[model samples]
Target: MGELIQEFNDYRAKMNDVILGKQNKVINRLFNLDTNCYAEGALSTKTKEMLGLVASMVLRCDDCIKYHLGKAHEQGVTTEEMYEIFAVANIVGGTIVIPHTRRAAEYWEELIAQ
Candidate 1:
Protein backbone atom coordinates (compact mmCIF):
# COMPACT_ATOMS: atom_id res chain seq x y z
CA MET A 1 0.00 0.00 0.00
CA GLY A 2 2.82 2.42 0.79
CA GLU A 3 4.48 1.58 -2.47
CA LEU A 4 1.25 2.22 -4.37
CA ILE A 5 0.81 5.58 -2.63
CA GLN A 6 4.37 6.59 -3.42
CA GLU A 7 3.90 5.65 -7.06
CA PHE A 8 0.76 7.71 -7.31
CA ASN A 9 2.44 10.69 -5.66
CA ASP A 10 5.35 10.46 -8.05
CA TYR A 11 3.01 10.32 -11.01
CA ARG A 12 1.13 13.37 -9.79
CA ALA A 13 4.33 15.33 -9.29
CA LYS A 14 5.60 14.49 -12.76
CA MET A 15 2.29 15.38 -14.35
CA ASN A 16 2.25 18.74 -12.57
CA ASP A 17 5.78 19.54 -13.69
CA VAL A 18 5.10 18.62 -17.31
CA ILE A 19 1.91 20.66 -17.40
CA LEU A 20 3.55 23.72 -15.85
CA GLY A 21 6.45 23.59 -18.26
CA LYS A 22 4.18 23.30 -21.27
CA GLN A 23 2.02 26.20 -20.13
CA ASN A 24 5.00 28.44 -19.54
CA LYS A 25 6.41 27.66 -22.97
CA VAL A 26 3.16 28.42 -24.72
CA ILE A 27 2.32 31.54 -22.79
CA ASN A 28 5.79 33.03 -22.90
CA ARG A 29 6.90 32.17 -26.43
CA LEU A 30 3.73 32.02 -28.51
CA PHE A 31 1.58 34.63 -26.82
CA ASN A 32 3.05 38.10 -26.69
CA LEU A 33 0.70 40.48 -24.93
CA ASP A 34 0.78 43.47 -27.30
CA THR A 35 1.40 41.63 -30.53
CA ASN A 36 -0.31 38.26 -30.20
CA CYS A 37 -4.03 38.61 -30.83
CA TYR A 38 -4.85 35.55 -28.77
CA ALA A 39 -3.99 37.53 -25.70
CA GLU A 40 -6.21 40.49 -26.61
CA GLY A 41 -9.26 38.51 -27.52
CA ALA A 42 -12.23 38.68 -25.19
CA LEU A 43 -13.60 35.29 -26.07
CA SER A 44 -15.47 33.35 -23.43
CA THR A 45 -13.42 30.86 -21.47
CA LYS A 46 -15.29 27.96 -23.04
CA THR A 47 -14.75 29.29 -26.55
CA LYS A 48 -11.08 29.85 -25.87
CA GLU A 49 -10.73 26.33 -24.57
CA MET A 50 -12.44 24.97 -27.68
CA LEU A 51 -10.23 27.03 -29.97
CA GLY A 52 -7.08 25.96 -28.11
CA LEU A 53 -8.10 22.33 -28.37
CA VAL A 54 -8.70 22.74 -32.09
CA ALA A 55 -5.37 24.46 -32.60
CA SER A 56 -3.60 21.72 -30.64
CA MET A 57 -5.25 19.12 -32.80
CA VAL A 58 -4.32 20.93 -35.98
CA LEU A 59 -0.74 21.44 -34.89
CA ARG A 60 -0.30 17.83 -33.75
CA CYS A 61 0.75 19.02 -30.31
CA ASP A 62 0.17 16.12 -28.02
CA ASP A 63 0.82 17.98 -24.78
CA CYS A 64 -1.34 20.88 -25.86
CA ILE A 65 -4.09 18.55 -26.99
CA LYS A 66 -4.16 16.72 -23.65
CA TYR A 67 -4.13 19.96 -21.70
CA HIS A 68 -6.84 21.64 -23.75
CA LEU A 69 -8.98 18.52 -23.85
CA GLY A 70 -8.82 18.29 -20.06
CA LYS A 71 -9.63 22.00 -19.81
CA ALA A 72 -12.56 21.63 -22.18
CA HIS A 73 -13.97 18.80 -20.13
CA GLU A 74 -13.57 20.82 -16.95
CA GLN A 75 -15.39 23.68 -18.64
CA GLY A 76 -18.34 21.39 -19.46
CA VAL A 77 -17.56 20.42 -23.03
CA THR A 78 -19.27 17.16 -23.95
CA THR A 79 -17.89 14.38 -26.15
CA GLU A 80 -20.36 15.37 -28.86
CA GLU A 81 -19.14 18.97 -28.68
CA MET A 82 -15.55 17.86 -28.94
CA TYR A 83 -16.45 15.71 -31.96
CA GLU A 84 -17.98 18.73 -33.65
CA ILE A 85 -14.91 20.81 -32.92
CA PHE A 86 -12.81 17.97 -34.35
CA ALA A 87 -14.93 17.93 -37.46
CA VAL A 88 -14.24 21.61 -37.91
CA ALA A 89 -10.52 21.10 -37.27
CA ASN A 90 -10.41 18.31 -39.86
CA ILE A 91 -12.15 20.51 -42.37
CA VAL A 92 -9.81 23.42 -41.72
CA GLY A 93 -6.51 21.58 -41.24
CA GLY A 94 -6.99 18.43 -43.40
CA THR A 95 -6.80 14.70 -42.66
CA ILE A 96 -3.41 14.69 -41.00
CA VAL A 97 -4.52 16.52 -37.88
CA ILE A 98 -7.30 14.05 -37.25
CA PRO A 99 -5.01 11.10 -36.66
CA HIS A 100 -2.74 13.20 -34.50
CA THR A 101 -5.59 14.34 -32.32
CA ARG A 102 -6.86 10.79 -32.13
CA ARG A 103 -3.47 9.64 -30.99
CA ALA A 104 -3.40 12.36 -28.34
CA ALA A 105 -6.81 11.28 -27.14
CA GLU A 106 -5.58 7.72 -26.88
CA TYR A 107 -2.58 8.90 -24.94
CA TRP A 108 -4.85 10.69 -22.51
CA GLU A 109 -6.87 7.53 -22.07
CA GLU A 110 -3.72 5.62 -21.23
CA LEU A 111 -2.69 8.29 -18.75
CA ILE A 112 -6.04 8.13 -17.01
CA ALA A 113 -5.77 4.37 -16.84
CA GLN A 114 -2.40 4.54 -15.18
Candidate 2:
Protein backbone atom coordinates (compact mmCIF):
# COMPACT_ATOMS: atom_id res chain seq x y z
CA MET A 1 0.00 0.00 0.00
CA GLY A 2 1.09 3.54 -0.52
CA GLU A 3 2.22 5.39 2.60
CA LEU A 4 -0.92 7.52 2.68
CA ILE A 5 -3.22 4.55 2.47
CA GLN A 6 -1.13 2.48 4.90
CA GLU A 7 -0.97 5.25 7.44
CA PHE A 8 -4.73 5.85 7.25
CA ASN A 9 -5.58 2.17 7.63
CA ASP A 10 -3.08 1.58 10.42
CA TYR A 11 -4.20 4.60 12.41
CA ARG A 12 -7.87 3.78 11.92
CA ALA A 13 -7.39 0.18 13.04
CA LYS A 14 -5.30 1.19 16.04
CA MET A 15 -7.80 3.78 17.17
CA ASN A 16 -10.73 1.45 16.62
CA ASP A 17 -9.10 -1.17 18.80
CA VAL A 18 -8.45 1.37 21.54
CA ILE A 19 -11.96 2.79 21.33
CA LEU A 20 -13.64 -0.62 21.43
CA GLY A 21 -11.34 -1.77 24.21
CA LYS A 22 -13.02 0.73 26.47
CA GLN A 23 -16.08 -1.55 26.29
CA ASN A 24 -18.60 1.23 26.48
CA LYS A 25 -21.92 -0.36 25.66
CA VAL A 26 -23.15 2.55 23.62
CA ILE A 27 -20.03 2.84 21.49
CA ASN A 28 -19.82 -0.92 20.97
CA ARG A 29 -23.44 -1.11 20.01
CA LEU A 30 -23.05 1.74 17.58
CA PHE A 31 -20.10 0.02 16.00
CA ASN A 32 -22.01 -3.24 15.75
CA LEU A 33 -24.96 -1.47 14.22
CA ASP A 34 -22.78 0.20 11.62
CA THR A 35 -21.30 -3.15 10.66
CA ASN A 36 -24.69 -4.77 10.37
CA CYS A 37 -26.19 -1.92 8.46
CA TYR A 38 -24.06 -2.71 5.44
CA ALA A 39 -25.15 -6.31 5.16
CA GLU A 40 -27.11 -7.60 2.16
CA GLY A 41 -30.80 -6.95 2.59
CA ALA A 42 -33.31 -4.78 0.74
CA LEU A 43 -30.38 -3.20 -1.00
CA SER A 44 -27.37 -5.07 -2.31
CA THR A 45 -24.13 -4.55 -0.37
CA LYS A 46 -22.69 -2.76 -3.39
CA THR A 47 -25.59 -0.36 -3.53
CA LYS A 48 -25.39 0.21 0.19
CA GLU A 49 -21.70 1.04 -0.08
CA MET A 50 -22.32 3.53 -2.88
CA LEU A 51 -24.91 5.25 -0.75
CA GLY A 52 -22.52 5.28 2.17
CA LEU A 53 -19.78 6.84 0.06
CA VAL A 54 -22.06 9.58 -1.14
CA ALA A 55 -23.33 10.36 2.37
CA SER A 56 -19.84 10.33 3.81
CA MET A 57 -18.66 12.78 1.19
CA VAL A 58 -21.58 15.09 1.80
CA LEU A 59 -21.00 14.91 5.54
CA ARG A 60 -17.37 15.94 4.94
CA CYS A 61 -15.98 13.08 6.98
CA ASP A 62 -12.67 12.08 5.41
CA ASP A 63 -12.28 8.93 7.50
CA CYS A 64 -15.78 7.82 6.67
CA ILE A 65 -15.25 8.61 3.00
CA LYS A 66 -12.10 6.48 3.01
CA TYR A 67 -13.84 3.60 4.73
CA HIS A 68 -16.73 3.67 2.29
CA LEU A 69 -14.36 4.06 -0.65
CA GLY A 70 -12.58 0.87 0.40
CA LYS A 71 -15.86 -0.94 0.78
CA ALA A 72 -17.12 0.38 -2.54
CA HIS A 73 -13.91 -0.72 -4.21
CA GLU A 74 -14.29 -4.21 -2.73
CA GLN A 75 -17.78 -4.28 -4.19
CA GLY A 76 -16.19 -3.83 -7.62
CA VAL A 77 -17.52 -0.39 -8.17
CA THR A 78 -16.32 0.72 -11.58
CA THR A 79 -14.56 4.01 -12.20
CA GLU A 80 -17.66 5.15 -14.07
CA GLU A 81 -19.90 4.28 -11.14
CA MET A 82 -17.58 6.08 -8.77
CA TYR A 83 -17.71 9.23 -10.89
CA GLU A 84 -21.49 9.14 -10.78
CA ILE A 85 -21.38 8.75 -7.02
CA PHE A 86 -19.03 11.70 -6.81
CA ALA A 87 -21.36 13.78 -8.95
CA VAL A 88 -24.30 13.02 -6.71
CA ALA A 89 -22.30 13.94 -3.64
CA ASN A 90 -21.12 17.18 -5.16
CA ILE A 91 -24.59 18.19 -6.29
CA VAL A 92 -26.02 17.54 -2.87
CA GLY A 93 -23.16 18.90 -0.82
CA GLY A 94 -22.30 21.99 -2.89
CA THR A 95 -18.79 23.35 -3.43
CA ILE A 96 -17.85 22.81 0.21
CA VAL A 97 -17.45 19.14 -0.64
CA ILE A 98 -15.05 19.73 -3.55
CA PRO A 99 -12.07 19.57 -1.22
CA HIS A 100 -13.38 16.29 0.15
CA THR A 101 -13.93 14.99 -3.37
CA ARG A 102 -10.28 15.71 -4.12
CA ARG A 103 -9.18 13.65 -1.13
CA ALA A 104 -11.63 10.92 -2.02
CA ALA A 105 -10.25 10.78 -5.54
CA GLU A 106 -6.73 10.43 -4.14
CA TYR A 107 -7.80 7.64 -1.81
CA TRP A 108 -9.63 5.82 -4.60
CA GLU A 109 -6.48 6.03 -6.68
CA GLU A 110 -4.53 4.29 -3.95
CA LEU A 111 -7.20 1.64 -3.73
CA ILE A 112 -7.11 1.12 -7.48
CA ALA A 113 -3.34 0.98 -7.57
CA GLN A 114 -3.48 -1.78 -4.98
Candidate 3:
Protein backbone atom coordinates (compact mmCIF):
# COMPACT_ATOMS: atom_id res chain seq x y z
CA MET A 1 0.00 0.00 0.00
CA GLY A 2 2.82 2.37 0.83
CA GLU A 3 4.46 1.45 -2.43
CA LEU A 4 1.23 2.07 -4.28
CA ILE A 5 0.92 5.54 -2.83
CA GLN A 6 4.57 6.26 -3.58
CA GLU A 7 4.15 5.10 -7.15
CA PHE A 8 1.08 7.27 -7.59
CA ASN A 9 2.86 10.33 -6.24
CA ASP A 10 5.86 9.63 -8.45
CA TYR A 11 3.70 9.15 -11.51
CA ARG A 12 1.79 12.34 -10.76
CA ALA A 13 5.00 14.30 -10.37
CA LYS A 14 6.47 12.95 -13.58
CA MET A 15 3.30 13.60 -15.50
CA ASN A 16 3.12 17.15 -14.15
CA ASP A 17 6.64 17.83 -15.33
CA VAL A 18 6.08 16.22 -18.71
CA ILE A 19 2.82 17.99 -19.32
CA LEU A 20 4.10 21.39 -18.22
CA GLY A 21 7.46 21.10 -19.96
CA LYS A 22 6.82 19.35 -23.25
CA GLN A 23 3.18 19.62 -24.25
CA ASN A 24 2.36 22.82 -22.45
CA LYS A 25 -0.43 24.25 -24.58
CA VAL A 26 -2.20 21.04 -25.55
CA ILE A 27 -2.04 19.43 -22.12
CA ASN A 28 -2.90 22.69 -20.40
CA ARG A 29 -6.08 22.91 -22.45
CA LEU A 30 -7.01 19.38 -21.43
CA PHE A 31 -6.19 20.20 -17.84
CA ASN A 32 -8.40 23.24 -18.09
CA LEU A 33 -11.23 21.04 -19.31
CA ASP A 34 -10.65 18.71 -16.39
CA THR A 35 -10.67 21.63 -13.97
CA ASN A 36 -13.89 22.97 -15.40
CA CYS A 37 -15.61 19.62 -15.35
CA TYR A 38 -14.64 18.94 -11.75
CA ALA A 39 -15.37 22.40 -10.47
CA GLU A 40 -17.82 22.89 -7.65
CA GLY A 41 -21.36 23.42 -8.92
CA ALA A 42 -24.70 21.68 -8.42
CA LEU A 43 -22.89 18.37 -7.72
CA SER A 44 -19.67 19.37 -5.85
CA THR A 45 -16.18 18.20 -6.74
CA LYS A 46 -16.42 15.15 -4.49
CA THR A 47 -19.42 13.86 -6.41
CA LYS A 48 -17.71 14.44 -9.73
CA GLU A 49 -14.63 12.64 -8.53
CA MET A 50 -16.71 9.71 -7.36
CA LEU A 51 -18.38 9.55 -10.77
CA GLY A 52 -14.98 9.77 -12.43
CA LEU A 53 -13.71 6.90 -10.30
CA VAL A 54 -16.67 4.74 -11.25
CA ALA A 55 -16.16 5.54 -14.91
CA SER A 56 -12.47 4.71 -14.60
CA MET A 57 -13.35 1.34 -13.13
CA VAL A 58 -15.88 0.66 -15.88
CA LEU A 59 -13.30 1.58 -18.50
CA ARG A 60 -10.63 -0.53 -16.77
CA CYS A 61 -8.29 2.43 -16.68
CA ASP A 62 -5.72 1.98 -13.94
CA ASP A 63 -4.18 5.42 -14.27
CA CYS A 64 -7.54 7.12 -14.27
CA ILE A 65 -8.55 5.11 -11.23
CA LYS A 66 -5.51 6.22 -9.29
CA TYR A 67 -5.88 9.82 -10.33
CA HIS A 68 -9.61 10.03 -9.57
CA LEU A 69 -9.15 8.19 -6.29
CA GLY A 70 -6.63 10.80 -5.25
CA LYS A 71 -8.87 13.61 -6.39
CA ALA A 72 -11.82 12.10 -4.56
CA HIS A 73 -9.76 11.86 -1.42
CA GLU A 74 -8.78 15.48 -1.80
CA GLN A 75 -12.44 16.37 -1.97
CA GLY A 76 -13.09 14.51 1.31
CA VAL A 77 -15.03 11.54 -0.03
CA THR A 78 -15.65 8.85 2.57
CA THR A 79 -15.06 5.09 2.43
CA GLU A 80 -18.77 4.41 2.42
CA GLU A 81 -19.15 6.65 -0.59
CA MET A 82 -16.40 4.75 -2.37
CA TYR A 83 -18.18 1.48 -1.66
CA GLU A 84 -21.36 2.79 -3.23
CA ILE A 85 -19.44 4.04 -6.26
CA PHE A 86 -17.72 0.67 -6.60
CA ALA A 87 -21.08 -1.06 -6.44
CA VAL A 88 -22.30 1.05 -9.33
CA ALA A 89 -19.13 0.33 -11.29
CA ASN A 90 -19.42 -3.38 -10.64
CA ILE A 91 -23.02 -3.47 -11.78
CA VAL A 92 -22.28 -1.61 -15.01
CA GLY A 93 -18.95 -3.27 -15.76
CA GLY A 94 -20.01 -6.82 -14.84
CA THR A 95 -17.61 -9.34 -13.29
CA ILE A 96 -14.57 -7.82 -14.89
CA VAL A 97 -14.81 -4.87 -12.51
CA ILE A 98 -14.40 -6.97 -9.39
CA PRO A 99 -10.63 -6.83 -9.41
CA HIS A 100 -10.65 -3.20 -10.30
CA THR A 101 -13.06 -2.56 -7.47
CA ARG A 102 -10.66 -4.25 -5.08
CA ARG A 103 -7.82 -2.19 -6.43
CA ALA A 104 -9.87 1.00 -6.06
CA ALA A 105 -10.76 0.13 -2.49
CA GLU A 106 -7.14 -0.50 -1.66
CA TYR A 107 -6.17 2.80 -3.17
CA TRP A 108 -8.89 4.59 -1.21
CA GLU A 109 -7.76 2.99 2.03
CA GLU A 110 -4.16 3.97 1.41
CA LEU A 111 -5.13 7.53 0.60
CA ILE A 112 -7.16 7.80 3.80
CA ALA A 113 -4.31 6.45 5.87
CA GLN A 114 -2.13 9.24 4.53
User: Which one is best on lDDT?
Assistant: 2
lDDT of 1 at 33: 46
Stretches of candidate 2 off by over 4 Å are none
lDDT of every predicted structure (CA atoms): 0.67, 0.95, 0.87
lDDT of 1 by residue, 36-92 (tens): 443325776778888987888888776667667666766777667877988888888
lDDT of 2 by residue, 1-114 (tens): 877788988999999999999999999999999999999999999999999999999999999999999999999999899999999999999999999999999999999999
Clashes of each: 0, 0, 0
Candidate 3 lDDT tens digits, 2-98: 7898988898899788777776687889887987998889998888998898899999998899989889888888888878888999999999999
Instruction: Report the C-alpha displacement of residue 111, candidate 3, in angstroms.
Output: 1.6
Give the TM-score ranking, best first: 2, 3, 1
Report lDDT (Cα) of residue 78, candidate 2: 91
- Structural similarity to truth (TM-score) of each candidate: 0.60, 0.97, 0.87
* Residue-level error in angstroms, candidate 2, position 82: 0.5
